[model samples]
Target: MADLSSNAPANQFRIAVKKQKVWLASALILLVTALLAPDQATESLGFVAKSLTQTGPYLLLSIGIAAWAVATGADNLIARAFTGSPALMIFLAALAGGLSPFCSCGVIPLIAALLTMGVPLSAVMAFWLASPVMDPSMFFLTSGVLGFEFAIAKTLAAIGLGMAGGFIVLALAGTHVLHDALRDGVGNGGCGAAKIRSPKPVVWRFWEQSERVEKFGKEAVKTTLFLAQWLTLAFLLESLMLAYVPAETITSILGGTGIGPIAIATVVGVPAYLNGYAALPLISGLMEQGMASGAGLAFLVAGGVTSLPAAIAVWALVKPRVFALYIGISLGGAFLIGLAYQGWTLL
Candidate 1:
């Protein structure tokens, strides 16, 4: 009779090999399909390339922060900082989230790092929801393109919504709802359930360890590949959206102050909002065409918060429940903000 223990390792290896072959075969089929649809493939590839180009600076920022955190043992420092006060930490996390310039996908590595180091998911969610909406550049661009009122309102909403998300998540903490996102820190006070752990070495200086750079390099490569695959899928789906969704379909409402128009704007914006920069011009055009200020505000907010790329990035990191909560925060925030703007305008 064969010894079960002796074959366990070999059986596991075989299973892993089989999974890889399945993936390889799937990739080949996709390659063949792409070759058959050359134009569609080119368009999709172009968008992916463009997305990578746009994401480079943010990716560098994420990688830099991750590396520094590992080298200086900053994850532990952050964990300790989180221990100070839950209320304040939520506010600060949301505030930091607003200040980031990275797109949603670009922030994934950093989010992963924070979570891996046992940072609380609620704080991470706050940062996650706020970061994509407006950074300094986005702020300036919005002010220039959409006017000070629109820009200021969005800035306020980002922070408020971020804090709102944090509080809601914190309130729901220690429940079955947060089980997946709370992850390692489940019952602990924001990533303190277990010891702080950085993905790579936790040396004082990067150069102190001979293998630190190599480890970081490998991690960077892995991150880049993981992001590339996900971003490519997002780009492809967005391209289909752009190809099919009619421009007039969005402008039909004339940006009215009513509930219907506002709701329409939010719905359209979820699928329609592309890069913030690109959306500015389109929104401007829509506004000029009698789009209501409230509708525009809702559209911009919803678009930025749940942009396809950002949502995809989010889904890649967190559980389904967390993703749903994030969407709820974005949508609810958009609705309230739009309502306020309309009321101010007496719409």
Candidate 2:
């Protein structure tokens, strides 16, 4: 009636102009502030530098994992591979989890996607426990800070716990739980239900048409966006840890002659999400102040496994009971490993 369609483009243009002005003004303000307040600017710069130093490894790891996920379509590949074999799926999940660079928060979306694709519960459990510990970036950080021997021990312990946890989950809950939880079914096309329905081809027809380019571009953007969100959150967490938590406090809490300190460290680390890279400085400080190797290892394991974000994500996707079981097993396994390390040292 009022030429509504003709005005739509004009409205969009106005909105775009408004957004541009807002951004421009914000940038100008920030620049002026930086010029006027050298101390605040320097402090901000220092904060960024410290955060990068602490969480750079994890950021690199996230990039590597994201690249792999994009290149191989890991979610789809895994779904296809574990179609009928629950046990095999469980093992693969653990392996994938171990290799994945995702932090606790990032791992959840992938896990949820996998579960929706009909992956076995055991495998999902394995991935849940193993991903944080087996990250390559974190491994590099550990090797640098904790030494090669401790790194090896940490890796082995993570894999063992993942495997053991998978079996325990499978035995207690049965494979049907997995099937029921992941009711969407498995396989390449079937796994990507939401994506598949969008009138887009799953496999790239590189030679067929130029439209594939657009599809790939869209996918790249999606992947980047997803990775960026998680990576930013992780970086922020690292910054907080560096700014607030003192090296001396961490050492005093975890270091001592009795098993009480080790146990306390494990418990404290569960809800406290910490970057493996940041732990290096803290560990170095502790060691300089006389903390035991075993105690440090315990802290590392607990921090990696008991991430609150991961636990919440797992709970949302899986049963509350299953989530509780996972937490219990992971905590118990970490404690046992710590105890073993302590005993070996005593021997």
Candidate 3:
């Protein structure tokens, strides 16, 4: 009989290729560009390299902080936001969400945990709205790619959206419109609920524990790879856009000082957004191509909240009506914030 051990290497290679599909696709794109347009390929490579170098420091810091939060178990502290009065919980939950290290996918289980704990839907809605929009790493990445001002505005927009969603749910809660929000069979949040179910005292000095130290190392490496691959793909696409996409086209479509472009952007963002990290460089390139700042903001905000992963999680966890409200709030809040940000820029 043939030895199965002989197949291990090939199997591992296949797994690696499958798992790194984004990187593989990016490489294929670069290869095709090199074969068809050598000069453009070279320029694109340089652009990606230079952009990565410039953003390296911010990337490292963001990764470090995220790893720290995970290793120290501090992320579980978010449960505190649900304990206070409904109004206070809404405010605190929004604030925690903006500052938390969770991502769109990572926040899912936590959301599950909150809901399973019988947390008020209004406060949970606040966290749900804000959590995916802003985080420590996102703020740093945004600042590095866009600007400090833009990052600050995005963070404020996140909190504002959360507040708006929370209060709206609170008002409607009296009518029992959202009373039985969770679906019938939705079980307690999977692994993410463990810490919340059984509180673990966060070890602020996690380095002291060998296991925590190992956890930090793994998290750091994981986050680094995740960010690197996305950013690399982003920069590559940005370079291609700069080389091929017409500036006048972008300007005519998205540059005008009006609500039309922002509205279009909010609508477009739902399907067009790549990933949060990937969109930054793409948006930066769009802005350079005369895409309006307001439009860009709207795109990011809308996409962040309603991206496929997050949207699917929300759909899977909630009743149909509750899911409708979530989508309505996300889209409406995104447009309003986009207009507000645009007006702020004018001032």
Candidate 4:
């Protein structure tokens, strides 16, 4: 027994040492990568730093929204609403998206969570389309940089497009695809359980529940951790783009005459993930280099929607048909909106 105990401790010590060595090796590799490609390293680090800074406040806001959803029992309310009529859920979701202040990245997970919790795909689609453009921060920024009229036009256009897209998706794809996409898993348990019954003196009863507090804390931690990981990855990707891709190249591709600008904008945007605020500097730069406002808008919309993280989340929760519909609608809507903006400018 004494010999076995000693051997166990030795084995445990070796495992701990091994873990430490592995971590050190990984850190060394990262350092080497950074030193070898300073520009890429700086860009990646800058992205992570910038994303963390922006996401700090947004994280708090998300927590508040999540809390509100939990408190009001509306987190999964859409599921209940959809039970009766999916179309109505779509409209409500679009309105909700318009009112929300979350950026594209911030909204994506929430939307996915909602879908996993049983929210209809149509509603999720509406929210995805509108949230970034209709966000208050984007509105304020747009107003400051682009003028109030432009801001209003963009906001209105986003809402209109969101609603139109939702309806179009519903009409073309039907609710079954959405149901199949979201039915299995959509949200945390906040919406899964039936409404919690309060005893007499409901206010007092609410305060008495220790379980709720614990649940809230756990959820807060989970969400924060999930967001932090994505934010880190996003920052790394953005930094790489900034360091390697020439701004002039972006402008040249999308700044020229004909539909070249629109095509270039869409192509460039599809793979790049950016928030409305983050994209603003790029948009301004593109504009300075003669990129059309329409193309810029298209770029913004496309960039916001096609995040790799968000796409992965969607793929995990939704069916291929629903996913295809989402991609098609977003691309189609962006193109049409861009064309309309271009024509308006011409007129």
Candidate 5:
């Protein structure tokens, strides 16, 4: 018994190192492949650089949020975001999701960190659903290409879907159907769970303490490293798609206007939906090719929530059940929203 207990930690450490090596190996392989294609690699590298630049500020913001929440044990403070109404909290978070500049991939670090800090799964799920669907810039761009009414409808759908995801998780909280929505390993596999010290007042002054600084530093590095590795892997995969997958292939299939088309859109959106800004023109072009309004909306919503980049980001930090719930809500919501938009169009 004593020998087993002593070896348990060493076993865990070995597993962790193995995981890190896999990520490192994959990243290194991708780097080598990208280097081999000098002309295409230039574009891929450019995309990576641009992505990192944009994601940096958001990553830093996540670090600050994570640091504070961890150091001061402020999950309660976040818990107090509303008056005991999970629905209202979900609504507010959904609104913030629409407002933030992040694409879904960019927001994962924050979501991962937030969940790690013990923020309830419902609100984070709410933000997760809405953030990628419609940001402020995406809203305006969608309006410019798809028109004002379409833009407004898409925005409403984004928020409504967010609310739906949050409430769905809330409803299932005590039920076995979605048990452990915030699963174990959420705080980096429970590594720092016990080490965290809740300062009396959850404030900035606590940051001055050497112990607090040390804790914050460890948390920051752990989070950043985890996020950066997954993100780089996601970006490398995206670069491959961008280099090879033709845009016309997407628009061609989306021309059909029925349930089948919408279903196809949902599936395809995962790999094809780049980002809202890039999608506006593609969706607009699809419309010209007889893409149904509802199908188009479905594609955008589905793509936003479950795109490869974003899904990979979420999967890296969450358990299988939580990830499945996030996806279930995304697909289900996208289908409903698409159908609703179609009905409105016919009216």
Candidate 6:
């Protein structure tokens, strides 16, 4: 009736806007601040600019590493971790989960494939627990936003949580507790299945191939834009948070070390968590407001593993009982890791 074909351009524009929601949101925040709080708007802009410039080198390094992984196909090595004995596989999987380049969502297809392939749940659980928490790009970004020590501690936490989850699942594997781990019809196929099922050999000298050079450039640009947009939004929000949120509020809730604050942080981390990259600047702002290091650690670890996106992906792939165990391991292991880091800081 109303010339539907004529509205194609409008529909396309709406789709484009939806795809760039983060960027649009960032722009909207700035526009509102400019109109409502003109003076603070300038400061916010300066803060975001300065912060981005400061982290520029680390950002570049992270982008390069990610691009290199793509070009050389080093990520394929992640599949190799499942080939050994249960104990050995768990060890390797945990380490790979810490070091591999896959994000939580990106690792989903691989996880599905591994489960379908009859890989033991122990090692799969280990990788699943750790993969969401840390990786090469994440390490450099955390180091830039937080500190080297903090980043290193987080990496260790990732590996440790994976190991703990793996072994616990290992012990329970024989108990029928983990029976029917995956949901029916869940692991048929998905986006990254081919990479896991038919991995290509790594070409360490990827520069020699014209296609690899093109891939490296494309990946570098894609990763750079992704990190830049998220960091921009994060820093902008952080500046506003620092300006508005009172110091005593954060301190009272998440400060002054001990198991109490750490546990609270872990619980809060789940719902309060934003994108991992965005959360870094906000957490830095919170810590500046007197949030304890242990609380910060717990918040990050828990959020990485149990954030809504990660949790939903897991739920879609696994049965309810297995999902419960996953959550249990994530929270429990995050708490222990937080305690360990807190003790380390004290000493």
Q: Top model by lDDT, which number?
A: 3
**What's the number of clashes in each of the models?**
2, 1, 0, 7, 0, 0
Q: Flag clash pairs in model 3.
A: none
* Candidate 3, residue 197: how far the Cα is off, in Å: 3.3
lDDT of each: 0.67, 0.61, 0.91, 0.60, 0.69, 0.90
TM-scores of all predicted structures: 0.59, 0.60, 0.95, 0.58, 0.58, 0.96
Residue-level lDDT tens digits of model 4 in 180-288? 5553545553422232111122232322566655655665675565445444544454455555567687667776546778867866778764545556545654565
Tens digit of per-residue lDDT, candidate 5, span 1-347: 36688889999999988879747754675677767877776776676567656556655665565565556544333323323467778888777666555555555556666677666678878878888788654565566557879989989998899889988888877776656555455554242232223213455665778887777788678667755665555555556665675656655666545677777777777788765545655666566556778888998999888877778866877668778888988998898888888888888
- The better-scoring model by TM-score among 1 and 6 is 6
- In model 5, which runs have C-alpha deviations exceeding 4 angstroms? 1-83, 182-184, 188-257
Residue 228 CA error for candidate 4 (Å)?
16
lDDT of 2 by residue, 78-99 (tens): 3333445778766766766666
Report the lDDT tens digits of candidate 3 across residue range 1-347: 99999999999999999889989988999999999999999999999999999999999989999899989998878877788788999999899888898888888888898788888899989998998899998999999999999999999999999988999999899565797889987778888888567768889999999999999999999999999999999999999999999999999999988999899999999999989999999999999999999999999999999999879878988998999999999999999998998998898
Worst 10-residue lDDT window, candidate 2: 182-191
In what order do the candidates fall by lDDT, top score first? 3, 6, 5, 1, 2, 4
Worst 10 residues of 5 by lDDT: 191-200
Stretches off by above 4 angstroms in model 3 are 1-14, 174-176
Residue 336 deviation, candidate 5, in Å?
1.3
